[model samples]
Target chain A: MSVTKKDVNYVADLARLKLSEEETESLANDMNQILDYMTTLEELDTSDVEPLEHVIDLEYRLRDDKAKEPLSHEDALKNAPDADTDYFRVPRVIE
Target chain B: MSSSVNDNYEAVIGLEVHAQLLTESKAFAPVSTEFGGSPNTQVSPLCLGHPGTLPVLNENLVRYIIKMGLATNCDIARKSIFARKNYFYPDLPKGYQISQYDTPICHDGHIDITTDGVDKKIGITRIHMEEDAGKSIHDQDPFNTLIDLNRAGVPLIEIVSEPDIRSAKEAYEYLKRIKQIVQYLEICDGNMEEGSLRCDANVSVRPKGREEFGTRTELKNMNSFRNVERAIDFEIERQIELIESGGKVVQQTLLWDANKMETRMMRSKEEAHDYRYFPEPDIPPVVVTDEMLEDIKEELPEMPDVRKQRFIDEFDMSDDDAQTLTEDRYLADFYEEVLLHAGNPKAVSNLILTEVLRTLNDRSIGIKEFPISEERLAGLVQLREDDKINSSAMTEIYNAMLEEEKTAEELAKEMNLVQVSDTDFLEPIVDEVIEQHPDEVERYRNGKKGLIGFFIGQVMQRSQGKANPEMVREMISDRLEQE
Candidate 1:
């Protein structure tokens, strides 16, 4: 159940983060400690317990399929960090 | 190009199809789901993945997926949950797509496809409901990819097939059937070029007798049904050639370069589907009740296969004609509606198969958009059946009817295209034809019976295509014998 340096590095890479060596080492140690603390709950045997899917027991609330007007194109792109007038722009991506 | 490698090996194929549901609203948001809005005009806070916004499930989305599941003979799960498949792309503004992971809404269905007169059943692995990502236009911008969130949160159903398809042709048949079923259900538009429907293929090859499979590559970006077949065929040949030349087939994603007619390697992502799927906490588990299933089943339109068989049995339609007529639900509905007005299924079928279909092709319109009403088309068919118009005359009247907005009878007379069935009228034309072509008449009486056609042609031409050839034939024979 130990979080290894490789695991931290892989996850950080997926998140597009470039952590320094010290930060990576610290994240690995912190994740390991958290896993170690959570392992204490495993000592209690609950083989017959049903897995809980949700904290609340309520079913999903559904809305009728009627459509409402969406935000204006201008408003939709207002908060975009990088955008042209009509589009939210990002670094060039290929398939 | 050679058959040697192909003969020694066989390819296995499975298709994953994504069909955008035609719900009025987005899958989880209450915003419009219309296609091709001025970029981002269809986006809401939830669609844009703004903080503090939550999604409410759309009722029609569930109903439509259930209709599709029933149409495809899939078992609808009593309880289905949405899972978040985490990924990072500009198109995926949420950084995760809400999809069904472990328990798909429908499973264990089978679609029967016929290829070259041989029927094979391809097993459906699963059909799950999901939300679509935004549109990323890479070619439209030089420095940055443009994103249109209008497509984000649009409802989609992913239909995955078992690795049961044997060849590219079978895959094609299977895809055609999938398209037909979805279109029939009216759950989706089933348009591939417009991206309402999309497909990807998983391809692998093995020796004919080998039970195990080779490494498979995934193919994406095929925009049409033809491209799907061609891509699979090209991938199969490429894999076989690689193995033939002592190269190993690697499992990776390739893009179908339709212009080049070859598959090229897609730039590999940081990780292959490193999507860590988890249960979506926002949407509570959905429970499909028995009453819901019953309602969906009752409302499910008759699927293409069943309707096709019924057409064959009920109307005495040939298999090819039946297949063509039932290819689209609207077209089949138009045929049946015409039959309500016209007697003689064979005649109506012929008219639809030839003239009506030609108009549809030439105009590039669907039956729903066809200009001629069922009543008018039925009237045209009846005229031919009643020997009032020859086939060519019927065609002329049909073509003229396209723009005039007049009934078939009104246009028939206006265009002088009706057959002159009266013996009294045709006899004069027959007399003129016989008197002018005495050599042909003499030859006809001397047992050159085939010259009757020449005489009939002359009479029709003289009458300006108005004389009934059958009546003219009978009178000419009697006159020739008597004279």
Candidate 2:
């Protein structure tokens, strides 16, 4: 499949990115090149090989179901761009 | 339009339910997963997506999911991987949710639900584990949307159902069964109102006998079971109307306005997220051992269907009573405990169905907070069985028991509500009533047979409601016949 400018713009919209015309053109070209390079893997013949989900073969590391101390309210909102006494405030978000 | 015209199409529905696991801590972080704490007080650095923080899986989360899988007859995957679903939302601290994409933990499960006296099996496509985002309260602030990260990093399991539901009623049954199973497994509280359990439905409609499905719309924001059914019904009608008007059904994401009872489009299919999924590098794939599966299987409680069948076979209960009793786990247990003491299943079931449930509703308390002990309730039932109290006296004693710590017998004695079956004690009252109500007696002799109720009422009043009604009726009938 070929990457098109419309597809790039649509993706950018979903990602909440404001892309200019020049940037959209360059990103579309970059995506096409990446797709072309990925097609090289289609030539490899490994019909019997199982698809890999993770690179490292490791078992899950699990912790007990215990609660630890969480951050205080003051520390939790320390880095908020905007906040009230307890909540992290953002510009009104409506669907 | 006529009913026949609306019946020309069939609606196809499938539901996706997200159940928040009742684990003590968040999915990956050590922050508390308790609900309704102060805002942001339950967040850890990892939950906030601070740099240099790594996630570790909670052991109970996996066990809880496996328990659900076994209960629902799911094929548990031996190896499951977590993937990062890239998205941007204010509630998502990490800007991407750690979820399962291709390798879900459970798959190929089927749950049987009975709707309209017909049992149908809804196929489960998959159950994947994921982390919940924080809450955004838009109504709390006038100018801003307030975010609470306490719910972030909470563990959740998304159960995806195959498109097998044929109507809104069937969808309702499917959701109820799912909630019952989760509550029985003790993994989720199954409170849709509290947001612990959430459902989103995909709905489509097609001409009758058509095989190819129409474009489907995804519906969200239904907070209750009734709303789920209502929304599906409204959407089906809307789609059918759209199709009949020469307009095609567009694939979109719609939010159900519960008050308005209509669905409004949130976004179309083109605006759907790609969710560029990749394996989460911070956590490793979960490997289920045979021993672990066996242990979880051993821990599985008796499911609702099996308990319902057992109640029918063992207790000789009616199908409806068994179903009503087994709908809630605690209620079923209470019924069983009463059975152990009362030894009469039908009677016990009747009492619970009427008096116990009425009291519960009147006081607005759950069965757990009910004041009457199971043993005391059984004792009351036993008293009625032994003819120590009549039905009215039984009700009075029950209401009294709710107020104070007194036995049924003690309450019966204190309130002078015991049944007086002895002939000598009731004969005088019967004779006096017969002598005093001479006109009624003559009318009774003239075959006004219904006056027996009035005579019984007088005798009961004179005896302070302690007269055994059956005995009084027999004695009074015998004396009147002597004339």
Identify the candidate with maximal TM-score: 1
Specify the highest-DockQ model's number: 1
lDDT over C-alpha atoms for residue B69 of model 1: 79
Fnat per candidate: 0.87, 0.88
Candidate 2 C-alpha error for residue B359, in Å: 4.0
DockQ of every predicted complex:
0.81, 0.73
* Chain B TM-scores of the candidates: 0.95, 0.93
All models: lDDT? 0.89, 0.91
Deviation in angstroms for B3 in model 1?
1.9
Model 1 error, position B389 (Å): 2.3
Residue pairs that clash (backbone atoms under 3 angstroms), model 2:
none
Candidate 2 Cα errors over 4 Å, as ranges? A1-42, B267-270, B360-366, B369-371, B401-414, B421-424, B439-452, B477-483
Candidate 1: pairs in clash: none
lDDT by residue for model 1 (B247-323), tens: 99999999999999999998877576788788898888889999888988899788787899999999999998999
Candidate 2 CA-lDDT value:
0.91
Tens digits of per-residue lDDT for model 2, B1-483:
557867999889999999999999999988899988988999998888889999999999899999988888899999988999998888998989999998899999999999999989999999999999999999988888999999999999999999999999999999999999998999998888878999999999988999999999999999999999999999999998888889999888899998888999885554456889999988888999999999999999999989999999998888998999999888899999988899888888999999999988898677888899999999999998988898899999999999999899999999998899999899888989988999999999999999999999999999988888998888889888887
